[model samples]
Target: MTALRFPALAGLLLVALVGISRPQPVAADTPAPAGFAAFVDDYYAALFAWEPNQATYAGIHDFDEKLADLNAPNITHRADVLKKLHERLKTLRAGKLTADEAIDAETLDHAIRAELLELEVVRDWKRNPVVYLGKPAEGIDMLMKRSFAPPADRLKAVIGRLKAAPQLLGAMKTNVENPPKEFTDLGLIVAKGSVSFFRNDLPAWAKDAAGKDKKLFAEFEAANKPVIEAFEAAAKWIETELLPKSKGKYAIGPDAFVKKLETEEMLDVPLDKLLAIGEANLKRDQETFVATAKKIDPKRTPAEVLATLNEDHPKPEDLVGATRGTIERTRKFLVDKKIVTVPSEVRPTIAETPAFMRTGGFASMDTPGAYETKATEAFYYVTPPETEWEARRKVEHMRQFNKTGMDIITIHEAFPGHYLQFLYAKQYPTKVRKLYTCGTNVEGWAHYAEQMIVEEGYGDGDPKVRLAQLNEALLRDCRYIVGIKLHTEGWTVEQGKKFFVEQGYIEPETAFQEARRGSYNPTYLYYTLGKLQIYKLRDDYKKAKGADFRLQTFHDEFVRQGGLPIKLIRKIMLPGDTGPTL
Candidate 1:
């Protein structure tokens, strides 16, 4: 349910293609058709101008001098821009354009609509500004890791942004002056994490770059001093001014939440229908967990079996080694099983999660975006155990990295999952589909991959592995229910945490962390929901194809179509016109 409020299509477009270069102008072909290319060019120009940070990420240097103004006033201004863009896009006749131009038009049309839908229909910003917590840090992190600029040039940009830190903090204060107490408290947590970017992580990055660019490194350190102070000051403000005002009630309520479900997720099903599906899946997963647990230890109850299994799994001595082992084993399993095709360009490395980008979600895979070429390609970042945590808390935190959980995470983040999906997406022929991949499709596929591999007899014929996979799915299913209920069903945070701990079998601290995450990310439910759709799709496709269907063939075909929405995937696979529309 992570409710990120950034410009949508712009970000997707920036990251759509991995290695594509800027197109060279071709010789005149019927004068490039009337007003079509001009329209597309103008649309992109307006977009980049409005969102310069997006351009920087896209490797388009045309707007490097500017950063987006994400304050409330600018959000309104951007909303107006989106409205106008949508209107203009609607005026263009698709039939009048060439096939390529037509596709571009449709892409622009969808992008424009998606932007407007987010601002006007979703209105997430009005409900919560906690989405801003990791944004500034993400800006810094992306520029450092993903951009094509030289270390000096990149450091220069970092220094420039660092100089603006105080101003940015001031704007943030003004923006959230009347924010919900819950959001403000969350903001403080995020700010504390964000400050680590400057106080701790950046120094290491600066040291790495210092060998090649000493002057830039010096400037970076000097500039970061004020930025670090500003972040600290902001954190203090959250404790004092913001946290006190964070209380009272701030639910979207059932009606608005339902509207959001219908529009934002494009879910046509009613709340009860969705709940029914969730309940059914929950029951099924629990049964599988129980049955599998019985196989491992017949004398124990399901919960007792889980406890016994947790005790039996390997526990690595160090965090890095633990994560590395999980990743390597999962990658090798996929290759050995031939479950999914691995890309030659794949380079899945685990790294410490940067401070600035540490809120809203736990772990994320940063696949190379469309315009990025010759950059550090992919990373699976795991948040380090916080140093300030007490001994018991630290132990609980480390338990999150238990061997089985780490393996499950590796399945989601790397092998036959996100990294693999992105590799095939890079080969997709259509730029529009490639540019705007669906989260449900991408995340769902990974979630499905976790269970698929285990069900297909991975882990050396151990049912415990399958049990672990189901437990992970159970956690996600609980996320779906909790996320919807908390945001729309008037369930309190405590209630949500209770649901996580009681039903999902999650630890107390983990439950609290997940509940807080659901505050802003109501649609985080899509990981499991999407995975369920993919699984159902596979079953239906297999039945339809009868004896001809093969798991590898189905998987290859499914992924090769780009990460289209499952609705569109239905049309692609079933070959019928009555496809579900977003």
Candidate 2:
């Protein structure tokens, strides 16, 4: 039997161990393939040993005794391993492998290539030492706070890693001895938020798991004090030394940005094409917004209507209650319309955004990771209104957080969206398909879901709700334009911010934040780009299926493909001689 090469799978598993064990036999009659299954099993074993915190997150406790080494030597060693694995995969013949084995091999190939690309093409970690230096070496802490593992197990992992916290800090210091100033500045900002993971959240978990593990709390407090000190030192270094020297520019220029776009997203189109798509979507969504605005108030123009919507928005009397009400209403709409079957496993909870994660956005969904067997749940985290703000500023912020906006966010971040899609993804059998999630498909589906549900008349004739939905879509469209323009078209931060305010209809402060974030996160474009790809794929699939193409059936099948790249979606949906072009 030919040796089925799966170095790619090994590479991905190495990053953060998902719940892939041995490759189960294809069926009873078809015996397990020889080399391929062995490759997968061996890869899983190595992964668990190397990254115990990762294993714990995946619900595998065999390696709960150790933690990942974020030290320089370990990072170098892993890079070397990835290089060897990529070479090994290149030597294997895919045609000789079994059908299932071939799929695994293909996935492995993609993963290895991606890792190699990251190492070769991306030099941010090395060039901007502050980026690495500023990061908290508390994967265990993160896993615990995220509730990826049981409280007891998470506590144990935290204690184990805490014992090595000094060494991790030493390694970080060594790595950042000559770090870039920009990295240090950003690192300081991120680090200031770090201690809260232990100071506030860890104690809550300890209280919850009190009777089960008495020693856990003591161990946590003992280990955390030193870790907090080290983080404080790192933060000081970033603020004092790094920020002063941060002469480095954030953008990587057109060529690097294009390569990053392709590498990160596996997108085929150039940056200009992406910008064009964004512009088109912005125009389309704006028209929809205008029409909806007219419905809300025929006398007012779209711009005037938008201003009125903002003017009549609510005060912050009971924020959580208001957001929860929106969620319940959205769930009812999904069920009533029969838009798609929501799995019983879909349960969404509203929570305050963790301080560490608030840098990313005002709200985000914490979907169940691939390895989770528990019912897929999501966290619709709303960042708490700023406490120190004066009454007027506070009220203005509250006005920004209206019921219409919350409903739009709920539809995008929860029901019939990320949580629902994730529940469907859990049903996919292939480890490669399940583990290697496509961000485009994931975010895109949620973005598309927001508009899709709104178009189906979800908000009980409330044009404010519909207007908010279009505004969100427009925000994503602005992201795409700003992302491409900042990186590929040499647009400055000021230009990007202006474009957001003008084209996206976003507030100046929000636009500024969005533009700044785009400099570092080029992948933000995935929201609109992914939606467009899915929409195109659906239209083509519908035409091909002819009379059989029910919307729910199409949505069910599309999501069942397990968040594969849209390029691969066409292959799965239309599997014949003439497949859709990339």
Candidate 3:
């Protein structure tokens, strides 16, 4: 069947897509006008100053000593600046710019408008308490994560941020009113984890980093005291003041949800149509899951077959070693099959998930920002089952990292997934493309890799491997349906959880977490949504190239475009194709 293509829905994307011309060769003496390029540079300069923590993460250390001034007036002023930038961007003619620069302009324009939506319309700063608690904690962690600078230098920046936490939390207390109960719960979790980070984990690191600098150590102690107290107070206030009043609905409603898709992903499908697509995909993956399970064992039910796979996981003591082995094997397979270019020989450090990040999930890829240079180490964090949990609870957690599933997880998190994509960051053409990423282009690519590799014979046509791949796909399919239903159809969390268990074949415990995450993270359906878009793009590109096409060539071109919306990338790769991206 021919895949469906979505039209550009929002006025902004239409403006962005206007005068879309092919790239023409320019003589060395006759360069394109610097108007667009100069504005991009100036815009990021202003952005770095306005949001200092963002700068730190981008490896710009000039702003490392400060946190963002998130006071209401400053936020208003920042939005005002972005509004003017958006206007200025619309004036630039795409005909006058280079092909790459025009796409960068579109990316930057979308990013600006999206920021405006958050600041003016959605307003998470005023609604979600997690924004306050999570941002500051993340700021410190970013500094600590890599040795971007000398220990003393990074500690100094950490102290500077610590001193500013009280004001940030004060803004949180003032701005946050009646967020959803799930958001409040998240805020409380962040607050408690933040307090623990400051009180326990931080001081131990500080002592080692501070060394013999008595004055610096004393200053660190002084700054850290108030930050700990502030988080403690924030947690208390959330429980007593916020949770009781957290009666706000998590739904952004149909209109805002549609608008979010347009602004963030340049997608314009209607909610009912989008939901229909998700539902159809869910049914498809569920049927595949049952058939694949039967191939593994015809006598057993699908759930019973999955249970046997779960028992194939490593014990707690062997978890890290087992994961490390899979990473090498996956990397080797990609190179051996010539699946895609592995630009670097460097491997990501496989480690236990840090204390602050272990609230949920099994494994993740934590790569440095594109602009980050000195501290370029990427981490593939796999959270082991906690020792304190009862044996049954531990068993349930370990099932997530079962050997067959871990192969899929490793591929998603490392080889030719996020870590592989990061290697091409320096090659991205523009600063705007480097800085701005849409979820569809990023997470979508990783999810797509899971199926692509399996289809290409990663597991050598093993039914167990095929079932594991389908298992992961079903989880993402469920996310697509549940995310839309929760926000647009007014489905309750329990309803969403039940859908995961029955349709996705997920365990009830993990199902509850995935459903709750949708309340706070409404657009997570991007995993499946993005994978489908890429598949559509690949199918179209293959027809265009026909005899000359190579799978490696297509994969290479996709990531080289950086993380623009797949729609914009479709325009870049297949310039004249006015088709839907499904």
TM-score of each model, paired residue for residue = 0.87, 0.85, 0.92
TM-score, prediction 1? 0.87
Which candidate wins on lDDT? Answer: 3
Candidates ranked by TM-score, best first? 3, 1, 2
Residue 210 deviation, candidate 2, in Å? 5.0
Question: Which residue pairs in candidate 3 have backbone atoms (N, alpha carbon, C) closer than 3 angstroms, thus clashing?
Answer: 5-580, 5-581, 6-580
Model 1 per-residue lDDT at 172: 71
Candidate with better TM-score, 1 vs 3: 3
Candidate 1 lDDT:
0.66
In Å, residue 548's CA in model 3 sits off its true spot by 0.6
Give the 10-residue window scoring lowest on summed lDDT in candidate 1: 1-10
lDDT of 3 by residue, 425-517 (tens): 666666666667777887799899999999999999998998998989999999898988898889999999999999888877778878988
Q: Which segments of candidate 3 are over 4 A away from where they belong?
A: 1-34, 386-391
Cand. 2 Cα-lDDT: 0.63
- Residue pairs in collision within model 2: 181-246, 182-246
